[model samples]
Target: MRVPHDDGPPPPPRPPKGRKRPGERAAEAGASDMSQEPGRAALSPTVAGGEAGESLSLRPQSLAEYVGQAALKRKLEVFVRAARGRDEPLDHTLLHGPPGLGKTTMAHILAHELGVRLHLTSGPAIEHKGVLAGHLTALGPRDVLFIDEIHRLAPTVEESLYSAMEDGRIDLPVGEGTRARTIGFELAPFTLIGATTRTALLSGPLRDRFQIIEAIEFYGDDELAAIVCRTASILGVPVSGAAALEIGRRSRGTPRIANRLIRRVRDFAQVRGARSIELADATAALLELGIDSEGLDMLDRRLLTMIVENFRGGPVGVEALGASLGEPRDTLESVVEPFLLQRGFLLRTSRGRVATMKAARHLGLELPPGWQGALDL
Candidate 1:
């Protein structure tokens, strides 16, 4: 479908020829723009290393190329079609869920499907109001400003975005006393796409600003297998269906992890002088990486072992768990805990975290005598 680039026709001539626009003037004055942050030339979904770095090339450019999230895709397809029919910008959208379930990919896909330029920034990157202003004013109508880790936005900077999201304008406070008038700068009607791992950290007002809020769920094994195979094809590595499924099983239901594991497995196959990746190659690679058959990595095993040994199979608070493991609370909650909780390896109760019998069995350790009945709750 031919997506609308801008909101209808261009505005009639407002500024004379050769005159700089407000945004251009701001740029000329060397205003700090977070969108121009170093190493942000591309909306890379992963860090620079191994398969993570290679994911940039594999990132889906359009909705058609995206994988998984069937429900989200169906709704988004209808929404995009409707929005396109009206020649309007998509409503501000907030995508919240655990990391690496394709939030960033979905953001890029939305902008691509809208046929608009995507402005990328992270909440921590927008340190000051000038940075936010610069980004807001620079956008043409219907452009997408994607902010990752939206929950980390500073209160002041986040407040600065309120008017921009609601009224399509920003109030710039200038001067003092008698001349302390706030100048309202009109912004083009653009879409703000905010992604966050912890939506609860966002202030209610900030959260409410988004017209569409959706949580991305983890992909099933079949979906992850498809993702692995597609990524293998993109990386020019031939992968057997069994090998792909094996890698997917150990991906912890995340596309990023699946792609990363596939690459590592492919490397192992190459080093072993194997012609193509197979189930054995994937198993060996994962074993070498300290990822067990149940997709439990070093940290995951550490957490489980710590709970079993130290906490007596756990009823431990996340803070206490983090303190014991020397890992950050955020890391424990967002990274390690999500997969464990999803896999039924761990449970969070009113008291604290409790490891299940399955987790103990995975480690080849017997659970505490009463633990099985306790886990039923």
Candidate 2:
């Protein structure tokens, strides 16, 4: 979304008939300018290398192309077919998950399946009521508005969306002083797809507005291997099944990470003048990138090491750990902790985060005597 430029003074409240309005011209300009910006406005975040990157993006344009989240895909397929049969917009959907699990890709697939235009924006991008209003007013019937990181929306901006989402209209105050009056503008039917990593941060009313709430889980290793193979095909690189599986195993169960590893492995193979990616190449590439067999990167290892060594096997607070590591608490909780806890390296308790015995073993650290009793192990 483009913020209109100020040129001395604002345009007249009403432009002469047959002439374009300032707002219309600004919107047109924004549309044209979108191509110049790589990762802004309606452009997919996963896209890189500008237009070339868009063609190579691993994002699935349809549910048939999307991998994993099998149950969610089946549900969406039924919903899309039903909505199309009734000639109505799909219900507002809330997709919650950890980052890079294809929440954004799912939104794109929804729009494509419904055969509608998608307006992409983020919670933090819509700063106020006017920005929200601009998006709402510009929609055509059955179009989609995808908001990423929806939990971060400003309260006032979120409030403005209630009527639009529920009533298909928006109420805005017009004029000023004693002449001030409220205007309600009717809007076309539309779908709002919200993606968030932190569902608990959303207001109850906002959460209730969504008709379909789906949780996107991490991909299984097999599913990730399939995604890696598909990505390699898209990149025109040859990859062995064993290489793909190895990359998948080290991707931490995320397709985005799997694709990234594929590209790095391809680069490594190309540098070595190898004809195709092999298990040895994949292993060497990941090791060179500081990823261990357990898929733990340097940061992950550092977190575990800090807990085992500095915190004495950890019954430590995330804030304290963040302070010592110079990392944000949110990053620790959202990014590092989830994977570690999933892999049994860390445990969350009422008191704080604790390093499990598995973490000590992984780090090759020896706990003091009687540690089992102290940690209730």
Best by TM-score: 2
Q: How many angstroms is residue 193 displaced in model 1 relative to the true structure, after the best TM-score fit?
A: 0.4
lDDT of 2 by residue, 1-377 (tens): 98898767875577788889778899869967874655432212233464368344767889999989999999999999999999999999999999989998899899999999999999999998888999999999999999999999999888889999999998888899999999999999999999999989999999999999999998888899999998887776788999999999989888878988888787778667677788999999999999999899999999888887888876789999999999999999889888888888888988788888887877789887655314634
Model 1: weakest 10-residue lDDT segment is 39-48
True lDDT of residue 99, candidate 2: 90
Off by over 4 Å in 2: 1-56, 372-377
Highest lDDT: give the candidate number: 2
Alpha carbon lDDT of each predicted model: 0.86, 0.87
Query: Among all windows of ten consecutive residues in candidate 2, which has the lowest summed lDDT?
Result: 39-48
> What is the C-alpha lDDT profile of model 1 across 1-377, one tens digit per residue?
98768868967666798898887788756634644555332221133354556767889898888888989999999888888899999999999999899998999999989999999999999998989999999999899999999999999998989989998999888999998988999999999999999988999999988889999999899999999999888776778999898889899999989977887787677657666687888888999999988899999999988888788887889999999899999899999999999998898888899888888777887666776324554
